[model samples]
Target: MFYEASDNDHKHGSFSEVRQDLVSGDWVVIATGRAKRPHDFLQEGKKAFRQPKRTCPFENLHENALLSLSLGAERGKNIKPWVKVVVNKFPAFQRGVCSIFHKTGPYQWTDGVGQHEVVITRDHERSLGQMADLEAELAVRAYQERYRAIKQDECVRYISIFHNHGRGSGATLSHPHSQIIGIPVIPSDIARSIRGSAVYYEEHKECVHCVMLKFEKNDKKRLIYENDHFLVFAPFASRLAFEIRIYPKNHVSHFEDASEAEIVSVANALRVSLGKIFKGLNNPDYNFFLHTSPIDKLNSFRHYHWHFEILPKTSIWAGFEIGTGIEISTITPENAAEFLRNIKV
Candidate 1:
């Protein structure tokens, strides 16, 4: 209900206001300019395409696996690996020796000198949410192993680990896989997040995320799932309708630093959260990504806490979001969390 406008007159210029979110300190545009009724966002459901295993590129992905793990003898030892991490054949950022910044026409550029790997699961249909808890744990272990290997290079400044589920979530292939990209510079979104947390830490001398976690745990209004080491909750100022964030219970600055027990707990929490979403919402498309401390400045980023976030494609972006850089989420996070929490996974 909160909005900001250039002028007080609501009658003129399709008046809109930019509201600053208290938690992340990011702005959101309440576009009364083109406001939408709540129910208008409940669009028709999408049909997920299932490509045949014969045509799927990942089905033959047996070679160049950076790390591979097996399920059990039940699946038979001759079967394809249960989970594997391999170099992305078509990488956004190609691997090469680290490069120095070179100037060109008032712009700076560097060789995309970083590793891009894909974490593939053997199943063509079973996503993380649908997989067994043990299977999900193995996949998460692959992520950690690759992260540990990629972060060792001094040239690498940031590592992005993300999963694209379904076609709507930008998955060109139907197979279940996650991507890891190492880059030379910190992404702008992550930089902003780090700076915001750093400022809060300077003011309060405690982890900002920990403070939020404590409040959310006691409040219980936004919490959906929790384990010994992690909690899943809808963010207070969600950019998307059903945005979910998974945070470690203990304050950990780096994802790579998580212990084996902690990783398993996180995997459990992640699987449950995703399962609830899949069941309750009827398998919506979504993207989940990890946010962790940059590899270059470990000491300075200690105040920052690492977490994973999932954003479901519940709504589409229109002019207001594109023009103002602020997204309008129709559903309040509390309601979304309640809906998700009540669903049995």
Candidate 2:
């Protein structure tokens, strides 16, 4: 159904109509005047963009190290380093007073009480996708360790772990690194996802993610990559072209709850997914983030399952998307998955 801005509905002005998806109950905006054909999104000669190593910040991050690991080293010998976890020099949220949630008239706010840290690898040029299998495993281990540490603080309600590759995905530094952030409140997007998952769980008496995985595995059309423990596939209602999600076959609620074997498998799955995108799409910019159960309450969110979402910079949001919180993809997810699945990384 379409919802146009009537005289009373228009607070400022009316330029677009809102359309709701019948199945997911999600809303989207369609601008009347501004629209582009799908062919406009296809351009030629895309190259992988990277910054030079001379001015790279991650190269000199030893002093800020919160945790460092040398993957394979013998006792009583020099240890060659693999990964380092350090406090982000510029943090979005910091250590602060968590007690106050002040309200001013109709507005409510609080201190930006949180922790932000970066997981950096030793290599300057190799991203997780290009890194060796062992290096990728170590990087995943670093993410888990930092997550385990940060969630212990009583002030933290949610933790986010994500990686931004290439310039378009919002990576300022040329070197590859993942970031972990701990915040006092659950983000609106995550809250909405949790609510949806909860509703599905109550209605079906099964994990919604598991149900999706089963269908995707059986169909094999939308499937991009899969291992013993994890499955990577393009979502049926993908918000962007080449959108990928990696879910553990096991119904684990928390990222930190994954066992050692599970962690390695997840790392492998992540590596393969990124590798395929890097090779197949001519190294397009992309962002991958984790969605897990909130750290505040464990048993309450048992219905929720953790997963990774990779969103490549395939298209830019225009007026229609900005006006109404909706995105349009130029390509079908099935085709995108098939293309990526055929790529030999």
Candidate 3:
């Protein structure tokens, strides 16, 4: 049986309803009531775009250092003393006792045991989009080096590397930087995705993301950038305007498995796509995070695709959105892809 709203009960205003995928239990917003006008998305909700260069902490590199890569390596020119991979002085997590699971009064908590480090570039004003491909590649290399070093710790369950740009996306400072958070618990979102992929593998003997990559690579409907090792596209079920994801074409479980050459290629893909979004959307604040197969599962999740999720801060959560935990995307992924496709990086 099917149902439709009749004219008597129908009202006129663009709104959105989120629909859940039956098989995967993932939510996708059905934009039946797309209320946003063109200019509505351009405004930054919480992003404090500009900062005083004089007070910028990164400009004077006397802070602590997790690891540093020189400018001559990637920037192509040694303009004074330049380095990447500066340790955040105010780190979220520091060297504590190993993450010992503890039982509180009727509650359980584990030590926030792990590492929190920032991957910062030399130039204070230049964002990743303004950097050379080699520079971007070096940033990725540092991520790899750090991940390898941190994962050996017994208390660490997962290491999440992510970047938040502008205040709207939760960057307290205006500096261009990325962060790595190593935690003892597997993130809830990643767990859900892993379960979904596992169920899909059991039922169909194939990974759902691989299926999507194959389809997107063939159709080119949502694709924004493609290289030998990676592909970036607006997801079929995008969470926000101009939301893009970068995926490895190969079925690699761990991002750390990526070779130096593959890392460079992935860097090019990331930089170019980010450049498109940065240019096309007029420097929208965004966040990018890496989701890879868990280290606990050995030789498993080989079917899963490792990827990066880039979510631009284009919209805010309303009551409906907050209550339901579903994002309403006004602009269709197709249209968003079209907008980015025209932008030359």
Candidate 4:
């Protein structure tokens, strides 16, 4: 196994290092170079922020309570709508007559076989960074509940749940909301992840993610915050600097089956992580999304691990970035984490 210094890896302190990932065979530069001490990561005395309730669209969300959550209540609130799920006014994949597939030319496409829902909270402003733990938990529950329902569909092969915060983060409106797009075809990224894990599992008879978790746990430099069930950490080679990842300790394949308690734990970490970013960088925009096993072949994904990725909008990709998939991060993740770690929550 490729290894680095558990203690001497980050001499600049704040737990900085570049660790390699096993499954994708990609090296992640998980530098905590600029990271602040753990005690420095909390948000302190600041102006009590509010988005003027008069303009808040989510105040009376009952007007749009399309789906009931696992509990009696609806999903999301006005406080942390940034991370919650809301029904999309214009759904990309709307549900119609559920029919089978058909072949057209050499290409075969199914009857838009899935559901699309938006996870909206009761707020026009105040992102997950400013939300309460309960509010964030409520958002995660909505995702799980919706996933459970969507996966039951015979035609759905994959589901994507993602959040976009701030105008730069692709928020059409200043509202906080997440989107669930259930489609018949598994995403290319998901396929690659599954393929990588499958190949590794066949050769080693081990879950690569699990092995990474073990190493990360042992070396806590990259670890941000970990709860009873989940872990939040920065990757070694973050595509975008300060990229954060949340993973469940249990190697579960499907996010649809996540328990209520698990959701609470995840939402807590997710919110805190965002809050750290907000305070650290003075309200920077960010995007976060979930990656889980596909519903079509759920069992085959046992080798896979579900995780959430949070990418802050520190810089925009120009023409060169758009043309090529390769991203150039001006600020190293180690420095970004240093900036975030010092934030007071």
The candidate that wins on lDDT is 1
Please list the Cα RMSD from the true structure of every candidate, rounded to 1 decimal place. Answer: 5.1, 7.2, 4.8, 5.6
Q: Write the per-residue lDDT of candidate 2 for residues 3-93, one digit (tens) a residue.
A: 4565322231345444343224576444433543333344347655667787888876656688887677635857454899988889999
Model 2: residues with Cα > 4 Å off, grouped in runs: 1-47, 73-81
Off by over 4 Å in 1: 1-19, 29-45, 75-81
lDDT of 3 at 168: 77
The worst-scoring run of ten residues by lDDT in candidate 3 lies at 5-14
lDDT of 3 by residue, 70-189 (tens): 645325654733446765688777767786778989998976777788888777767778788877877888889998888887777778999998887898878788898777788888
How does model 1 score by TM-score?
Answer: 0.89
TM-scores, each model vs. reference: 0.89, 0.86, 0.88, 0.79
Candidate 4 Cα misplacement greater than 4 A, ranges? 1-21, 25-64, 68-87, 98-108
Against the true structure, whose TM-score is highest?
1
On a 0 to 100 scale, what is the lDDT of residue 154 in model 3? 71
Q: How many clashes (backbone N, Cα, C below 3 Å) per candidate?
A: 1, 0, 3, 27
TM-score, cand. 4: 0.79
lDDT of 3: 0.77
lDDT tens digits, residue span 1-345, model 1 = 844565222231445544565436887654555654434444346676589889998877656888988776545456543889999988888777789999999998888888899999988898999978888998999999999999987778999999998888999998989999999999999998998898888899988899989988988888898889998998877788779999998999999999999889989988998898788777888999999999965378998899999999887889988887789876666668888888888
Question: lDDT per residue, candidate 4, 1-345, as tens digits?
Answer: 655456446554445444445666554333355544433423344332345666666655544565644333435643222333455667777676666667888887667757788887654666777877877776788788788887777667889999887666777656677889988788887888889889989999998788778877777666777789998777655777668988989888778767777888898889889998887766667899998888755376888888899997765777866775545554455455555655668
